[model samples]
Target: MRGVTRSAQGRGELTPMESRILRAAVRLFAEKGFDATTVQEIVDAAEVTKGALYHYFDAKDDLLFEIYHSLISSQMADLDRIIALRLSAADTVRAILVNLVETTASRVDEAAVFTREMHKLNADRMAAFRADRRRYHETFREVIDRAQTAGELGTVVPADTAVLIALGVVNQLPTWYRPDGPKSPQQLGTEIADFVLAALSA
Candidate 1:
């Protein structure tokens, strides 16, 4: 099993050393493929010693796991809390999309690295990642499924299909979403939500 950081972006979740190592890793990982980025390079980039890097992460792969885990864990926490509010389906979906966009946009480097290197995670880490992803997918599916079952939304497609379509676009944003672009993540999320709700409402 790889080392796991509780929350990469959460204030106080990581020590200053942990944060520095993580930032350096994201930069290096984004610039060079994970296979090409060495631990010594990470230490030099972060200006930390080998001991500091090893203290926080078990190995380079552990660093990779941490980079991807932290982002999803953060998103899942937001999703869980928003869903607990028991908002109407449209509102819940809006909260989720907006949060997802904002979070993903803020962590583009992590997302990009994960997209390219995630298949390398160990079996245990892979299982954990899969569980986190499934929870997120199922939660969103339930929202749509419940709405359709209650006759609140049009049944244009299965809940799984709708979820995949919605997540697919956001997941691909790493290739082209520019933080300096005209729209802020919030605005983009709202626009996306509007489009998705339009489909459900029709």
Candidate 2:
């Protein structure tokens, strides 16, 4: 995911109108299923003309794809940055998990909406989505694999299985996590990192 090109809004900077429209779309899509969300409703909520929305996004599907794409793209960039630091395998993995948990928890609405409505993405967007996710998974797995090969991490579980186990918990965050919960994202992320590191070291 290092060299992957981003969407039209490269570098994740969204124009004011784009941001407004996306926020409205995410809220509407979360409240009403994607199938039930209307372009008019989105425009109304965004307080923008239909033409303004069209200028930024080609269709409603684009909005849905962008919702998740922005999140994953930022995560990928963070992963790349973490890898570049060349930290010890334990520290690297901890940083990755902490960033992932914090980002996903911060945007629980985007994650939840995308999880439910991603099937509606067009074929091309769907393929891109899968590719992005695969790249993320493979990159994380490679980190674990390298650590295990160098005896930096215990091989209690295979690298692939370890990646799955680690991400499985993060992926379920949108289901039950609340921003107003007792634990802050940093606290939760640190706890998760500790748990994974303890298991790998054991």
Q: Pick the candidate with the highest TM-score.
A: 2
Q: Each prediction's Cα RMSD?
A: 2.6, 2.9
Every candidate's lDDT = 0.85, 0.88
Please give the range of 10 consecutive residues that has the lowest summed lDDT in model 2: 1-10
Model 2 regions lying over 4 Å from their true place: 1-10
Mind giving the per-residue lDDT tens digits that candidate 1 earns over 171-201? Answer: 9989999989999999999999998898899
Report lDDT (Cα) of residue 64, candidate 2.
Answer: 89
Candidate No. with top lDDT: 2
What is candidate 1's local distance difference test score? 0.85
